[model samples]
Target: MRADNSQHIVEAARRRSEYTRSKAVQALRALDAAGEPVTFETVAKQAGVSRSWLYAQPDLRAEIEQLRAVQRRAPRSSVPARQRASDASLRRRLETANERIQRLTDENRQLRAHLAGALGEQRAARSHTSPRGAASMHEGVDIADPVQPQQPIREREQ
Candidate 1:
């Protein structure tokens, strides 16, 4: 009697498997009709099967995945091939900008050198015209006076 009961259980399981297989095929047809991407989750949901169970069927999984790959390769208007070419053109613009920067840097250095030479000449002329030991002519302050030169030091010493 136990053997008969076990055989009945096995037969019921087999029937359930066949039903699931038919359902999976129907789900794949539905996905194709809808023009939607095929995925394991979508297939499982449509077939009323668990995701783990669908994935365990390797042949069905491979067929659905190949369909998805074909969909991925189809062209879309949003990302055409010319955008990559534009990026290459942008690189050329960057090179031109770098050249301009280098030119400006050289001009700045030349201007700075000319300014330093002019300033040095002005300082030399001022020193030459001013009296010996006198403050700079441009400043207009008395740094030294011949009459009072030694008096301040002598008073401080005393």
Candidate 2:
């Protein structure tokens, strides 16, 4: 008859269970500390244990559920509440941007009107200098170069 060795086998099983439990607890702590999501799958993977085994542990299961709930309720942003910009600050920035856009639009409109008037004056000067039925004096002139008026020379009175 074989000698009874059930006691030794039972002792080894208990030790294995204790070791596994400790590993799961450590994994839970690590995940919580790192601000990572605390799910049973995550804890099981980190601990190198089976999900079924983690679910069987009542204390760990409860803690995991509580942490998961808390995480769901908490904000997901990495930035702390104190460092976030206020609503008023955002609104003021938007208003300033809009004002700058309006000012630039007005400036662009005035510049375009001034350019049109100068081009009209240049065309009139070209027409007056060219006789009827003759080629225009400004035929080869580039429109981009604005026409400058010749200043009248004032004679000094002796």
Candidate 3:
């Protein structure tokens, strides 16, 4: 009776071990398929095990994850690769655009400075000229000899 009971226990333990290992593999595969880094919590949830249990089996975790990585790179799909390349291209384009914007901004500042200097010089020249006040006076207004404004000039001997 004792021998039979021990055999039964061994069989049960073996089955449990197999079940746990299969679960770990499936969890690892799912994580790899998602194209995301695996975490203990995510693996535990996928495997239907406690996080502590998953962590306790380091060798199994490493082995299963290694296999998952191999499977992930085995000519499966091109979507991730294309997305990576596009992301790199977008980053480069953004950097180029920023540089162009900076250069244009600098050029605009220099142009503004030059225009201001030219305007200042023009203002200084205008201010230096004498004001022409008598240009708008009426032709009939006489400045000298107001009473006899039309009389001819008379010469006197010294």
Best by lDDT: 2
Candidate 2 C-alpha lDDT tens digits along 73-157: 7746343333446889999999999999999999999999999999888778866774442333345432332354322224311
User: Residue 147 deviation, candidate 2, in Å?
Assistant: 56
Off by over 4 Å in 1: 1-3, 75-158
- Report the lDDT tens digits of candidate 1 across residue range 1-158: 33458888999999999999999978977776666667788898899998898778988888777766655775332332223246668899999999999999999999999999987897688668855545443353445565665334346459
Please report the TM-score between candidate 2 and the true structure: 0.48
Q: Local distance difference test, per candidate?
A: 0.73, 0.78, 0.65
TM-score of each: 0.44, 0.48, 0.38
Comparing 1 with 2 on TM-score, the higher-scoring candidate is: 2
- Estimate the overall C-alpha local distance difference test score of candidate 2: 0.78
Candidate rank order under TM-score: 2, 1, 3
| Highest TM-score model number | 2
